[model samples]
Target: MDYSKLLSKTVVDLKPSGIRKFFDMLSGLDDVVALTVGQPDFATPWHVRETGIISLERGYTYYTSNAGTVPLRRELSAYMKRRFGLSYDPMTEITVTVGGSEAIDLAIRAIIEPGDEVIIPEPSFVCYEPITRLCGGVPVPVATLPENDFKLTAAQLSAAITPRTKLLVLPYPNNPTGAIMTAEELLPLCDVLKNTGVAVLSDEIYSELTYGVRHTSIAALPGMAERCIVVNGFSKAYAMTGWRLGFVCAPPEITKQMLKIHQYAIMCAPTTSQLAAVEALKNGDGDIEMMRAEYDRRRKYIVEELDRIGLPCFEPKGAFYVFPYVGAFGMSSETFCERLLNEGRVAIVPGTAFGKGGEGYARISYAYSVKHITEAIERIEKFLKTL
Candidate 1:
């Protein structure tokens, strides 16, 4: 039997994630200073951890409600209202998920049918396109420009649509580019979406990490709430990545459908994580603030250092990553990343890992200690001089 022929075409056609290959090559290589992977270096806050511990000490381990613990859902609803001015009916609009990852997967599976097209802005999160394909949808990647600060314009949206477009993945405070869509930026896209049948899968996991201005959601735009699925989680905000917890809020119709897929695929989110996340929702405001402040400080520092070293990166508005152009060095993004790892012993992901629009760039995450950040930049600067 030919193993290659045995695989499904969808699995065979899928390209492996470019980011993971570089990371795999760098693993256990003792000298590399990595700015790869988008996760906060901070530990989960003590109180949040304590809540999980206390639950375990009392032997509270068991399967939770299919939606999640009622207490957590209630606190999550209140947390959204308090933090983002979005009101969700905990009983009808929310479904707890494994992570923002699972929330994204569930959202696509909930609505897309074969031949449906999912509009994805390039230089955005990688998962959107692959997951869309896995759900039997065709991914239509619209290129977002660095000149536009990587925000997708209304014209782009208008041009990308067709009768089969079932959804758009709105990844703001976005991953590799670190670009965010302001209220002004989003409103016109909302207008473009106004009468269309397409739904928006808004990933707002980075919403709480913005500096200076608040993050805006497409769901918050007038007339969008009913047509949007908002995915957020405690991973970035509360440093709970390993805990694997997240939630999605949408109109009851969509949520009801999403719940069916989630219920079958995940059963429920983690019980211990749900209990601790309740504490996070109730009292983690200070922890969010502290982490945001630290990221901002590093954000400013890295931008300055990169400029000082002649990299000239755009100052990222939100999230913990910086994307700097590497075109001047006359190397492909993959070659640059590979050579950087092999020569300078520094790890970063190629921008093309995101999409074609990211060809001449590389993504460096600031989710590490300042000392590590400083050291990484210093080495990067030295590496550039040799180039």
Candidate 2:
């Protein structure tokens, strides 16, 4: 059985994420301290958990509507309004997804045509490029730089677009780099987009995790609401990653089409998780505040520690990862990450895994407790001296 010949050429050609290799190597290595994965180190809030428990106890275990439970959608609509001043009609403009991961996949698959180009800003999320390729669209990576604070400049966007370009993957409050696009920074790109037919898929899963400033959505920009599909979830904001729930809000026509795909591919997001998300949407502001505060403290400490150790990193304004320049260490990112894990017994992801622009750096997640982060830094300092 030559199973290799049965796979799609697109799937076969795609390179696996380098981050996974480190995870496989680190598995069961008792001596290593891992700071690789980006997940909140907090439990799901008690009230949200209680809602799920109550739902199951009350025999509410049946599958929800294909789009999701109506009440959950309504609560999400209100939540979006209160937080971002964006209004999405629950009945027509929204579809519940398995996770932000699936929401991204659905949006790309729903709109992108064969050979169409999807612009992805690098040092952003890992999923955007590969998923775009998988959907028979060209993955056009726009490399971001540390000199630009990892933000995608309008000039970069202008250079990346072509007549075949059909979509732009907007991943702000970015992973790996922790870079966020400010309102002012986004205006020039928005101006360029105004005259183009290219659609925007704004991933705002990290919207509630920004430090110091309120996160801004492209959907809220004038004229963009209708052209954008906003992907958000309970994962980062509410520490509900395990709940496996997310939603997509887009134009009614697009939502209708995406719902068809969602209905066939995923009958519905988990019922208990949807019930828990309702509680999160309605009453989780305090939980968000407390978690954000804790994350900010860790964010500051990691940046300061990295600077003190001569790693020269950009102070991240949003998200919980610190991307530190490792060019001074005189090694490729893959070699650096492997040696760091094997020798220093501390796990961090090589930045190159994010994209080409991510070379010469590494991503350290602040999603752990302050105590673990402190120990990681101390170990890092010891490791640096040995180099």
lDDT to native, each model: 0.91, 0.91
Tell me each candidate's TM-score.
Answer: 0.98, 0.98
lDDT of 1: 0.91
lDDT of 2 by residue, 347-376 (tens): 999999898698999999999988898888
For model 2, which pairs clash?
none
Root-mean-square deviation of candidate 2: 0.9
**Residue 229 in candidate 2, Cα distance off native in Å:** 0.6
**Predictions: Cα RMSD each:** 1.0, 0.9
C-alpha lDDT of residue 254 in model 1: 92
